[model samples]
Target: MKKAVFLDRDGVINEVLSSRVKFVNKPSQFYLLEGVGEAISLLNLAHIPTFIVTNQGGVGLGFMKESALHNVHKKMIAELAKYGAHIEDIAYCPHKPTAGCVCRKPEAQMLIDLASAHNIDLSGSIMVGDREPDIEAGKKAGCKTVLIGDESDNFAQANIVFPHLLAAVPWILEELH
Candidate 1:
């Protein structure tokens, strides 16, 4: 089976939106965090399939429509293309926390679904992201978890934590080999 890398959107991929970048409802709002494109390209060059696991509750919460999210993703893909990186698959949970959807991060269902659908060997895969939930999902899915930020000095779910996605590359490459 093949291994994959799952990435989170929002603060992990781009700066967390605020009044200035307020929700990424359009292509213009889609910006890449420093080293994101290069990091993704590095994973691509290493022959790792990359996937995006995002919690787009904005749609369910009425912050934006689904079409807007699609547009932003399309733009995001085009931008990544310029750097020779591409996401193999994308999955999102549009439900809010109150809705308790299965696909939400920290639940592991998204990873499980993707693993099954993509024929991934969960044990060999790594889930890299910035939030606790992202790491938790990886743990629950039985993959190696790498937290892409030292925001919280104490993250119990992740086996490892680094300052950014770029820092996690060599480990991911090693894990695949």
Candidate 2:
């Protein structure tokens, strides 16, 4: 079975505006966090497939249109490609947090679906994110979890916690070895 890495989009892949408590709703607002491209490039060189699994509640809340989100993702992918990094696929739940959707983070539906479609070995896989929901989903899906951020509260659930995505890559590489 193939090994894969699942990443949360907002804080994990891009800079998060803490004051707003929301996602980058426009391409103009989207900015790749430092070292993220290089980190993803390292994973690509190691032949590990990476996928983005995110909860896009902004859509359901009418904060932004789905087309706007797609535009942001397009720009993100294009930017990553410039660094020779690639994302295998992106799975997002466009439902409100209160919608009780099966595909949101903290629920393993999206990861399970991706694993089934891609023939992934969850035991050997990893999920990296900056929130507890990300870790929760990873655990539910039987994948190791890496929490990226300095939040004290979010640290308890992750198998490994790092300051950022780049900092977490070495540990993942070591585990693969």
Model 2 residue 69 lDDT score: 93
What pairs collide in candidate 2? none
Error of 2 at 4 (Å): 0.7
Per-structure clash totals for the candidates: 0, 0
lDDT of each: 0.84, 0.90
The sequence of per-residue lDDT tens digits that candidate 2 reaches over residues 57-76 is 99999999999999999999
What lDDT, from 0 to 1, does candidate 2 have?
A: 0.90
- Candidate 1 TM-score to native: 0.93
Report each candidate's C-alpha RMSD, comma-separated, in the order given: 1.6, 1.7
Predicted structure with the largest lDDT when compared to the true one: 2
